[model samples]
Target: MATQEEHPLIAEYRRFSPGSETLAERSTAVFPGGDTRSSAHYGPYPLVMDHGSGCHITDVDGHELLDFMNNFTSLIHGHAHPAVVAAVKEQASKGSAYAATSLNQIELAELIVERVPSIEQLRFTSSGTEGTLMAIRCARAATGRQKIMKMEGGYHGSYELAEVSLVPDPNERGSLDAPVSLPIDKSFPESVLRDTVICPYNEPERAEALIDTHAQDVAAVIVEPVLGSMGMLPASHEFLAALRRATERHGIVLIFDEVITLRLGDGGAQSVYGVIPDLTCMGKIIGGGLPVGGVGGKRELMQLFSPSQENPVMHASTFSGNALTMAAGKAAMEAYTGDEVKRINALGERLREGCNHAFQQAGIKGQALGMGSLTNLHIASNGVLHDARDSIAGMIAAGHIPRLLHLCMLRRGVASASRLMFCVSTAMGESEIEQAITALHESLAELGPYVASERPLLVA
Candidate 1:
């Protein structure tokens, strides 16, 4: 099955994406990394977009790819859903922004409150980064505690502390009980590291003990039910429940950063796990495809942001409740009913199963692990995976295969996050899911020789 010994892996990528390379060269003179967004950047370059509709996106090179990436899973209905497009267009025609409250904002908030069990009152933000940031600050203000406990490898946003200890280096990740807060980049301040208490993910007893140990100063325990950036590993029920129990007992706020996992169910992952959080941070589908985010919870915690309060948290964003985003969110939520959510979740399950089968057939050590609508492809030694260490090990073993696999899928008219995370959109069904699976099977086959020649440990 060895194709060509002379051709290198990255050369294959360059061959397939000449347009992206051209665009990257053109972009480098302006943007620092030849791209404005660091998350979207990969080894060679990224596909430049032309337009998208439904689940398909046409690139600048005229390739129509099935968009599994879906703008990092924010496009719940996939690009330009009729209802969302209509709502946004109508709102835009009327007015885009007003530094005051609007009916659309209220309607969108009502829709979110109605579905999410824990969110009684909510505050909108321009981005998920702000949502999580505000949630943490609110927790601190409410509890009067300065420190926050976050799971290792859990990425809440782009901010410093949110990403502290996010990439646990073997050289610096201290111990399992007390993880050293490793900065993702040089910009992270010492103060940000000091305020953070790192907790090992999925280690119930250790995590609970750590949370309890720092209970006095720990303002909040923030976690993602589905670990989005760390290879899409879902937190075990016991771990999340432990955090809830520990935080409750110690007067520490428990926040579910559902920015990604809210799509798991009608009421979010908290509903799925049967554990409630004191505060929930939401993004993605809530805004349809528009840029929006929000933080919400019981009135007690949420009310801290209310103007009626004497000393309210200073949470402000100019476009927080912009008319266009609100209208888009309302329309998106209105069309995304309980039944529709379940349908997409079922489709997600189908996609996962198909991808797993593809890995088996291709003789690769990998698995698709996630819950509900979100899934991530991990090149693991086993079919099962649990924690951050496992995810890191798998990535190390796979080496260039993940990037190569992503490129291979792209060439075959499929699109996924550079990290290989996928979310099912309402625009997708079994056929689209099957196309992705077929693409994966073929991509893995095409990659087999490279895997054997380069990283043979990846073979099952």
Candidate 2:
């Protein structure tokens, strides 16, 4: 809920987007909280987008805003790329899905196998949630173990165990050495918490020690190279290497959840870090703006899903590897070459640098921290953010400033994740990057007085 003091910004937003406000009010009659997806929802209400082209999305009020969020970094080519649209149209005319395998599915899988080092064989699912769930099941079947070790802030999917200790509350998270498995909400079962071991992000020695203690019952150790929900904090090579060494020593399957981080390079973050995992779970950009998920690994492990196996992992989904998604994904991935990856990554650096400078110029205690096409804003004293705890502390200290800033940016003709995560798409260029930076400068200027009065600590 928004506080009374936040009404000014909320009022300004409502005034600017009266059409969206009406739509949101009407939506509450059907959808819960005026929105169906929780991640896309914000405090006041989200802008209802009508259509998108290139990097610009027009809301219902006909406001053409630059789309930096890219549908939470899934739309790598931004909205409706010609090639992707062509492929989807062609496939849709034939048929959306089929009970048997299709050529597009085989082609996309081959492309992925040729690119990613960790995935020798793979299977698709309807969403990233299913991808991670299947990966965990595969590990348990192979190792005959019940426990799964995951990072404190790492988010795999929507499932219970995948979300264990997702938000590291400073109060309930216990100590740095031994973090408690805290749930995001009351829906989580106690059994999920017990089965999950929470490892501190970016802490190498502590993670190794935890793995050593629970090596016996642990089936798999899953991690994201770049922690997505926790402010896009990138994991250190040493920390990932530590996980690899420990998991290899214990004979535990190591899984890398590269759903969001696959945009980092041609072969994903595992290629960037040179620390390979036994199983790699993927989604986001791989789906080419469609709902898709996949998990792949060494032949020995992935073969467990083979029907020929006496007792396979038992994976089945109605829309897994559907024709329309496969066609779209193939076209999108084909266009996303190594050169394109390099270009967008350079743009990401430009965005982060410009945003950081904007914060300094506005005299605000904030900074942009992320790597290669992904950026997240946080309020901090030293601009030094290491983990979820650091990111959440900065958020708590800033009160409602972050939410206000999001609205201010949207009004200034820029759109990002409500939490302030930004990414570069193929449709964006240096001009769009500069536009976002300029919007940040103006938004901060508007909010400067409010921060000084209500949140003095945030006024640097």
Candidate 3:
């Protein structure tokens, strides 16, 4: 199916997913650049997925791949899990949504509150963006402050400020103590830069200084327990502790954007670190593969959103607590017990070891970094990355190898985030983990000669 007219690698890729190219050609007319989602977009064209079951997905080109992307870590139970499908089917038969509230919404909320200690009371939203937005509004309503202090590489949502300095250029980003709020895209307004006070990640002292400096005007300090967009970097316990202490001292609300990290445990990443945030934003895994998001926290703070209040924050969405999403979420969360969390985390540890082994065996400068079931591959000699700046160093060391590696893996029947994010699902067992490990070794082998010929520094 590959056309001989293209580059050998592109031709081989086309051969593997030829139908994808044909579909992509047609898609460009409908969707910009043949893709609606930017994260999933890559060179040539992404494989057009036809269907999925458990931990595997089949493309239109007839290539079956072990799906590690899991719809950007949303499918904790993987595609078409029996429980989720049954829930969706039953809810669909009745009705997808209604003007009135449903019992399913309460059930899902109760489930989340039971697991996460910080979330004494909660509210649902249609997406994580709304969840973070409402959390900030609640903070402002409570403290009567406007500005927010966020970590240098933290990504809370799709908005301009939420992604401020998501990929901070070292040249533009100032000192760690007073990091300049740099916009990732041109869509950002100057107001976003003025309102957001950027703090260096994993630097407790710098974070403390920033919070103290902006304490008077800072309403909330938001951060991700594990920086998802910046290479799965885990925030240090000391750093989080600093934020907690500073926020408490300054009456500034602390928000933990646990959207991607809710999968870390039944209690989420905050439980793992033993440091709780005043507010927690959640999504992905909780939605049961349907679009969903939530913000939950202490009773006093949550009271700001209560309708009983005279001038409460007006938070409304047609699909905020929709029945279908709640039913599916309840099913997924109920099945994803504490024991299952431990099991998947154990499997993640195995996968990490396997990847480290693969890099060593292949004599390549690559390492796997993450917490629990979440993982990201970094091409670097450095063993661990603590912040975006550290990740930039790794990015430079690897050059364009990571993208080539992703394409190579896709051809070898494996799929992950273009940024190389890999997560474990309840649908995957030791066998699937092993298969992925083998894929890593084979992928590196296929890439080794090219790296040796092209970039010698990548060789160990």
Candidate 4:
């Protein structure tokens, strides 16, 4: 009997990065799934990154790719920025971390508090997962409520509650008016599903009703202004405004998980939408490409974590405000001025427009969805995506075509998330944006035959 043949695209990818393929095999001896980080993993295998500088990275095979993924959007200034490098090095000479607060830590916090509209005070954590976890705990402690209201398909962090209904399986997700809380994996406990109230994304009325229904027990309503893992779907102002009104009327804490969306503006999505959240969970770029997280809010709500207060929320982490990360973060934030944000945001718009044109030129059904400096490609012709379900439908129809397109793009020297998510960084200029657009066009041309043969429905 003959063995099943590998897809031509996967075979091409394997050929293009044979060095990475060899390293991936070696990595499996120590790291599970041939990788330590699950989000960064892909098949036939992910590239073995040799080094990165500015907005470009070279794989072990000596192939250079424009770094659009930017380490899952954490490297806002791009890899090994001079300012960030200098700060990290300067701090390293002093010490990496300490048991006490560092000047950089205090300065970074002050900067965040001054910029973000919702964050009056904040406490750092080692990762975004911890940030959201502490935010939930803070709300529960403040409200004495047991339940948390999170949007369907909204991802806060790695925890059970934050990830409840993250994937939104169409079969089990129930009606849009009343989205049932379904776990992305089997690890979720029944109580977590019960404790989490799932509100449909972008449906203002439905979300308002859900909040009203669970007002008594709901401690907080946590949402992302632009749903990150859900194809970068931006929440409508009406939807976010509705949530704010509903949560306020119920006296429930309103938390904005701006972990990915913080780069959208000087004060994040809150300032852009003019919808103030009671609490905000942040990470990603704020850490200056290091591990970090933070939960901040109105002084009254944030005071819960104050050690000076009675029975404080018990916030403590070994590396929360370590000197090295703080120095790097401070330098990153300082370099990421308001003008740089605007410039990168314009590049994002240009990329999206160019991508949409490429899909049309290739006669493939697809579009780019996102806000400001963040963007995601979906294999759908849908005009405006309001929620995850809309994006998922396209993913289902395209089958393996999107993955094929990703591999093709990589061969063309552009790197994005395996899911086709792209982001613009300060290090990227108009030229880099154009380079990625050209790569996308070429990749789409390569995949046109596959779409027409295997996924005809995706043909424009």
Instruction: Give the best candidate by lDDT.
Output: 2
What are the root-mean-square deviations of the candidates from the true structure over C-alphas? 2.4, 1.4, 1.4, 1.4
| Cα deviation of 184, candidate 1, in Å | 1.1
Off by over 4 Å in 1: 1-9
Residue-wise lDDT of candidate 1 within 25-141, one digit each (tens)?
A: 889879997889999888667888889999999988788999999999898899999999999999999999999889989988998899899999999999999999999999999
lDDT for position 168 in model 2 = 69
Question: Which is the winner by TM-score between candidate 3 and candidate 4?
Answer: 4
lDDT of 4 by residue, 305-387 (tens): 98899899988899998898899999999999999988999999999999988888988899998999899999955577788
lDDT minimum window of 10 residues, candidate 2: 1-10
Per-residue CA lDDT of model 2 for 294-366, tens digit only, reads 9999999999999999999999899999999999999999999999999999999999999999999999999
Q: Using alpha carbons, what is the TM-score of model 1?
A: 0.97
TM-score, per-candidate, Cα-based: 0.97, 0.98, 0.98, 0.98
Output the lDDT of residue 289, model 2: 94
Off by over 4 Å in 2: 1-6
Across 1-460, the per-residue lDDT of candidate 3 in tens digits comes to 3555654566677777778888899989899988998888987788999999999999997788999999999999999999899999999999999968799998899889999989999999999999999999999999999998888889998898799998898898987767889999889999999999998899998888888888999999999999999888889999999999999999999999999999998899999999999999999998999999999999999999999999999998989988999999999999999999999999989998999999999999988999899999988664667898889878877887898889889998899998899999999999999999999999899889878877799898
**How much is the lDDT of residue 141 in candidate 4?**
96
Clashes of 4: 0
Q: Candidate 2, 107: how far from true, in Å?
A: 0.5
